[model samples]
Target: MNCPKCRAGKLQGITLKTKQGAALGLDQCSICGGVWFDRGELEGYLSGAVEVLDSPSLHPKLAVELDHCEASCPRCAKPLAKSKAPQSPRIQGDACAACGGLWLDAGETGGIALAEKVNAAFDSWLAGLKPKA
Candidate 1:
């Protein structure tokens, strides 16, 4: 499969196991180091059930700005809907409504994990604050 974002690299399948021991196979782009999640695969990462493998070279390219790029789903061949990753407005990803698939650019999966951690910590801190009398 070809990468939905770069459109140049072929996607290679990698097996990932969730915390609950459920195995999932996802596609990773060789050139851009992006990842493609099918259906609910991203949910596992959001819920802290999956561990993302380290891709040190996954960095945003200064030349390829995706803020306004219209990407197509590699699976369905349909135009993907652009949206910000949860808790990280700076990191944008494309979702395929037809297939419920998600495309995360280079370094985005790690960014999402970090953002969720920060948000959770902030929420906990806020909840612990006492009401001002």
Candidate 2:
């Protein structure tokens, strides 16, 4: 599959292993460093604590800027719907409404995973401060 963002970038299939030894496979853009995750794959990786953003192979410097318009799903060949994450609106995400797949720009996985961790920690701390009944 060709990269939706880079247009010319080839989508390379790679397997990412979580800390728990769970393996998830996805496609990544060799040019723009974006990732294409099938439905539930991103959630599974994050839940299992997969550290991937720091990988140099996944993030390569590109000579051209990424283009978002007209991006389509490599799986179903349908247009991708762009939106910001509800938990972290600053980070943009793309999804295939047809296939339920998700697309994230380079470094977005780290941002999302970090946010999840921080939110979990905050919730735990807040719960600990609640008055005993």
Candidate 3:
């Protein structure tokens, strides 16, 4: 199993909790900003059924869903396919249609859970800007 992000070593298997507080295997990369997911893991993350660990980078309060498209399954090496969640479209995620594996980057894990905030921030920033008549 190659590290999906760095493409160096096999992913070190580490179970991580999703936003919803369920346990899931989320490979840790430590070196680069990346993690690996097996099949159906994305759905769990998106649903807030799983949560990333609590760390300076990982937000414990916020259920973070991982997002990364340019990653391949440690086993199959097929380019991970991405799809938008029906609920949160602003976020992009990758999955292996063949195997159902998933991959998410560092910040991506937090974006989906807080998507509304992202939109709100954008809207607020736009409101502050002068509009051209």
Candidate 4:
């Protein structure tokens, strides 16, 4: 499969195991380090159940600037919609509305992981907050 974000990169198949022992198949780009997750894969990964290997740390100076580039789903050949990662406006990626597939740019997988951690922490803090009359 070819990467949707970087057309030059060929996607390689990989199996990711969740904390629940569920094995999920995903495609990743070799050249750009991007990833493609089929329906529910991203959600499953973000559910805090998957034990993903530590992705390379993010460096502000090395960040890749993404443009409003048009892309299609490698699975279905349908147009992909651009969307932001929940709770992290700065992290944006493409999604296939038809197949529910997601395309995360290089370093975005880790960014999403970080965002999920931050969101979880905020939720926990909010839960501990006392309501005043």
Candidate 5:
């Protein structure tokens, strides 16, 4: 499937197991550092299906959300909302509050959800198990 954010490239196929042992889809970038998510997958990942387990030794890439920015959903061209990361509440992501979609910035794919530090550790290790680089 193509990225809903932009026609930049097609979404890669990736299924990563979270620390909680739930499998989440991983949509990596072709040129830029971003991860695309199907609306349903995003919510499920956040709702604790794929719980994160964080570790300080791991420097997972942080997701910088452009939700409040001008960037719109490539599919609907609707504005996205800034929602707190699943693992960490402090970190945020560009979520299409209208469409239930999410937009993660370049390199932010690996960052732990700021809501829970313990979950972040497991999330990071699980994030590293993707099919590609």
Candidate 6:
């Protein structure tokens, strides 16, 4: 499948290894650093549980110029609608209504990861304040 953001970059299958030793198959754009996540895949990736093995850390470029052309779903050819990244309202991404696939532009995935960490830390801190049962 081709990248939804950068039409020129072909989507390549990348296997992400989780801390638990499980492998998750994901697609990434070699040129633009965007990632395509199918239904349910984004949750696992944003959980801080997934990591790439023997791969260079993803340094998403923040200055990439997005193609103004409407992004579409590579899987189903449906027009992708803009939506906020899960659990991260500040980060926006594209979602396919028909297929439930998501297209996150360069640097947005990193933002989501950071948001997840912040949310986790806040939850932990909040939990500590609860009255003893």
Residue-by-residue lDDT tens digits, candidate 3, 28-55 = 5664445565665556655554444332
lDDT ranking of the models? 6, 2, 1, 4, 3, 5
Q: Which numbered prediction scores highest in TM-score against the true structure?
A: 6
Model 4 RMSD in Å is: 3.8
Model 3 C-alpha RMSD vs. true structure (Å) is 8.9
- Which residue pairs show collisions in model 4? none
Model 6 segments beyond 4 Å from truth? 52-64, 85-91, 128-133
Quantify all predictions' global Cα lDDT against the true fold.
0.74, 0.74, 0.59, 0.72, 0.56, 0.75
Model 4 poorest ten-residue lDDT run: 53-62
Question: Model 4, residue 78: displacement in angstroms?
Answer: 2.1
Model 3 regions more than 4 Å off = 17-22, 48-50, 53-71, 85-88, 116-133
Clashing residue pairs for model 1 = none
- List, residue by residue over 3-122, the lDDT tens digit for candidate 1: 777678899988877778877777888777778888767666565456765553633553256434678999989999887655336667887879878788777778777876788899
Best of the two (1, 2) by TM-score:
2
Q: How close is candidate 2 to the true structure, as a TM-score?
A: 0.77
Answer with 4 or 5, whichever has the higher TM-score. Answer: 4
lDDT (10s digit) by residue, model 2, range 4-90 = 876878989888788888777888887777889888786676667566654234423442244335688989999998876443475
The better candidate by lDDT, 4 or 6, is: 6
Runs with alpha carbons beyond 4 Å of true place in candidate 5: 1-7, 19-22, 43-69, 85-88, 113-133
- Checking candidate 6 for backbone clashes, the offending pairs are none
Better of 1 and 3 by lDDT: 1
| Model 1 residue 115 distance off true place after TM-score fit, in angstroms | 1.3
Name the lDDT of candidate 6.
0.75
Q: Report how far residue 130 has shifted in candidate 2, in Å.
A: 3.2
Query: By lDDT, who's the top model here?
Result: 6
lDDT by residue for model 4 over 1-133, one digit each (tens)? 8877658778888777877888777788776677887876766767644655333344544334433467889999999888875534666788788887878877777767776788889999998896866
